[model samples]
Target: MRIPFIFIFCLLFSAGKAQEFAISNYDVLWNSQSKNSSESMPVGGGDIGLNVWVEDGDLLFYISRSGLFDENNTLLKVGRVRLRFPQNKLKEGFKQRLNLADGACHISGAQSGLQSDVRIWVDVHKAVIHIDIDHSKATNAQLFFEHWRFEDRATKKKENNQNSWKWAPQGDVKTYADEVGFENGSLYFYHQNKKQTVFDVVVKQQGLESIKDSLFNPLDGRIFGGFLYAKGFVNAGIEEGNYINTPFKAYELKTAKPSKRQQVLIALQTGQHLSPEKLKSETQKLALNSASSAKKDFKNNQRWWASFWNKSYIQIPKTADTTAYQVARNYNLYRYMLACNAYGDYPTKFNGGLFTFDPVFTDSTATFTPDFRNWGGGTHTAQNQRLVYWPMLKAGDADLMKPQFDFYQSILGNAEWRSKFYWGHNGASFTEQIENFGLPNPAEYGWKRPESYDKGMEYNAWLEYEWDTVLEFCQMILDARDYQNFDVKPYLPLIKSSLRFFDEHYQYLAKKRGSKALTADGKLVIYPGSAAETYKMTYNASSTVAALKTVLQNFLQLPNELLNADEKAQWQGMLTRIPEISYRDIDGKTTISPATVWERINNVETPQLYPVFPWKIFGLQKPGLDTAINTYKFDPDALRFRDSKGWKQDNIWAARLGLTDEAVKYTFAKLKNSERRFPAFWGPGFDWTPDHNWGGSGMIGLQEMLLQDVDDKILLFPAWPKDIDVRFKLHAPQQTVVEAEVKNGKANIINVWPESRRKDIIIK
Candidate 1:
């Protein structure tokens, strides 16, 4: 796996410039085998992911796909696979590498003059896994389909965190068994959910049982699994074994005769069906069809990967401060992880996103299955989840944003039902922590609540009245229309309903307080509100004010056909009722305030500077720039809470304010190599292993530093260091793309799409 000195020399000289490197230069290479699953590399495409590694002279991997939640709402792995060569061991001359440019894994080794090479890749457009092997001499092969959920297992205290019933189960919770066996000369496995699921439990807990029939139950009768087959392999029978802390039953397959070349295919299927026999028949058909078209599928997958890499990129050469170079390399690595779920039925989770390993590696003293992640699987924390999708716009991955938007659109009815049944209002009330079925997470909703408390509100301290986070996602939908010329007409209902929640619900609360629906000056009162889980019991929280004003303005600016006269007038009226962002004098300089007034501080979050980021109301070359900058420099709370950790945006705010030194210090620190063997496998920081929000926040900061589109003007190197040479291609608003590079302290604009936009480029 080590690059030869001659090859390195030729690469640099042939390219003619260090800044003009290809994506393959950043491919991960390892010369030794992994000790455990924690050291595995991620290889996946479309919605399928595999954690691949070579351990103890054998090849191993764990399979995972999107939307595989079980009855308890736990995100489950499909199963595990193990491959072994009887005559040749992989201990000598071993090499394992991830080829980022091709979206494939290549592993090769030699033992006592016998050599072997294996290639593993997933089809980008189909739910199929391919493994191709070649050997110097004929060798016997063994394939094992290992599954831990072969029998029902009880889940005790602390283990319930993986499911929806966190810390409050109705009774004994058990992970049911999966059906696994050899069928028609293939290893088949699947998990079918029972009729009773967490969706039913949450409905009754939230007093929405009357509307149970109207809800969308994603886990009801759900079936997920696949078949592993090879032309020359036969069933070797089942065996029991223990790996790590769990016991498993593995269905084995072996080669019928020694062969120099072999091909293995696995076809996965997931859907809701009542008859297991029917589902099995469909799965077999898919496997047979995939085998017939394997050659054409391989070519199409390669073409897809080639086009994906050509869309956009960022590359930097090694520098004196190695962290700067590491930052750029890790950026591409993390983006590849996000691309794994481009076509997922659900969005890539903010916690692990399809790349989690064993739990003991993330946290000790808590032994659980591979399905265990700290946060609940189906629950979506809007604050953390928004960070995961926001960077996709500037990276030119707008097509990848569809899954997230479609998630919200599918559940729009349930969200609006919450408003109508509880408050008789006319908008969607999406909470801070929501389930995939569009209800409050039962655990966060509190099993013990006072009889007089509002039925619609969560009784928890951190999440109550924190409904404004959904506006950030609504804004993203609109930004897609502006940035990529996306057809967002389908999402207008979701946007308008979310906007109406603030307008109608606040009026309802205002009437309950006294008389008039608005204040004397005619602005909606956003009282009893929380600001990003901080600044509790606030009045007119600055985050809410900024969100409402910005989203409403953007909503009104859409194309005429997308919004009729009545819809436009209704939103314009709501815009008039949005309060102005409040300000405070912190240590003599005026800075943005968390809220007009608040009762207590609950958590650590700098919502005061939210206007500087996400909202984009104040920043470089904009009004009140000094006030926003002063908030970062002088505000005691902002200073006390500054961090480059998970879901934190201080680096983004610094970039927007044009603070080059602070941007470099924090952005580089956030994007630097992780503690794990894989450089981009960052974090259990406030989340789980391979924490995606941590990588996402880092991506936003890096993109902001390189280029920014403000007021239809493209600014280059806005917060970037001048002397550090770098190359990047990023998207801009107005359907534009910018490609630029810097070498020896001078900047060059290589190409700008729609050449007429060249006049709008400004080199900072």
Candidate 2:
């Protein structure tokens, strides 16, 4: 029976108090000020991220914006802002808090009888950062915009990891300087990418120079940066200083007189222009408009954050296990970090996103500038990147998944061109280590190449023939439709092209080796493939087969209007040809195999259990559940390779299989507080500090523990401890939202959207 919309609204509100309790309890409060940038709190929205911290008596923050790639493809920080209240230096009573509800950072300190409060927030509707300062006593303030890139700096040795030329450079790779100046009572800075960038280098290296004009180069003529200003502030000359191991030049601004209240704004702009003067003019205009509408913008920012928090939440009450509660807290904290780039032009990077600090903090040997992260800026490691995006589905953050989708959309033309020029095929063949312009990383493409080798393949051992990771993104695009009613129209081309590559390419490979393109049974032979960078040189990789089968099955489910009869038949035919997942008898129990056969293992990933997690071929109430469980428990490689760090998904698989004990053990291990003061700055674990994939995998595992889908039924507490009291709201397929709670070993359905979905709910 259908419930009235009015009745549903009432039910939703009756359960609102529990959600309120959940979202409000996770705000991070620090009684003392931070000592360095490593202890900073993350605050951002739209496409900007700021690392805010206090040191000695000064308030400081690092400015970072998404898509700020330079000539070397480095995601450079704009600069650091240092603010000092000369007469009101912090001496006693210092507090810094991340107010999760409003998506803002609040910092306050006292000196003798005077006190100052500073609120830093980013505008969700605009690329503007606002800092409002109010003092109990009138005091003069000094602001310094410190930029380390006053002149070109050559990246040597391992420092090259920050760019696309990781471990190998064709020539001297230098991070060019930025233009900085004080003008019209404000400080403005910008980096205009030079005409020649790593994009040009990679194109020439990969033998794509013939189709160079067709390639999409994001670095060409790109300019990014902004200006900072405050009313009643005047230029106070420039200062030079050294911070950690880096030397910087600062443009100083001082208050005209003592003041009790002040407002400062930093407006950022990014675009491709032939003229630097035109770009600066536009940036200044953005700054002026931002100042005029500061009040309205602040209100709108708060409203957006309010809606974001209210969309979904998971709360383990105070009485729950201490470790589990901490995991829940860290979950929200890391989600805040992901939300910083909700509207970015590019996907949130798997390595660091925008909150990475000085490299020395992550590795003492890496004494490079703040721009340095272990992985190259524009290099997308699809294996790690998928982990970052998979959790967004259940969190109801499908809208935030656009940049990632559009990322593939933007690079589709180039991906297809590579297929046509190299293999004479029709489809997009995206590799695992891809550049922003949709080609293999120049270094990973290998400078030491054999003349007779195939031009299409990356000449590296681990990445050779590894092309199926793109299928995960294709699955995400399809799932967006089922989960959120998202219009998958724009992404249809990407999805079809990706599927076509596997269909046509495998046949091409088969014809080269044998008399037939298909096996005796007519299924395409997927030989010389890879199983998640492990089980290399495989025959019929189970990961590839499962991914293709699942994505194809989902693609055909779309309405007839989106897919024509011919297209449907074509996809349906391909679906029929996808081979069944191979299995092995492990310890006398049948379990899914990584592939039909493999020569050797190269990486630590457990792709045999991939079907249990991302592919969903086996798990829960589904057939072959015991077989999948046996693989996780009995496979020697899966046992030896199981981990909870940096892109590891053992916790996710444990939850998917409804193994509550193992799920709790691994999920707690993955989401536990890091050694850093801010708990979510997870690692330089196989990546970089604030490991986004680490946090993303943790989020996926936690959500999987609470809710799961088995056919049409919504299984609640599938892997959750019955004794743990919790309240949560998460997304489900068919445009549904499940809101429920558990208290004292009893499950209660607080509300379910559409009312019809309530019948689908099953407490495990």
lDDT of 2 by residue, 251-284 (tens): 9999999999987889888888746676667777
In order, the Cα lDDT scores of the candidates are 0.88, 0.89
TM-score of 1: 0.97
Candidate 2, superposed: residue stretches over 4 Å from native: 1-22
Which 10-residue window in model 2 sums to the lowest lDDT?
A: 1-10
State which candidate has the highest lDDT: 2
Candidate 2 TM-score, true structure as reference: 0.98
Cand. 2 Cα-lDDT: 0.89
Model 2, residue pairs in steric clash: none
TM-score for all predictions?
0.97, 0.98
lDDT score of residue 75 within candidate 2: 85
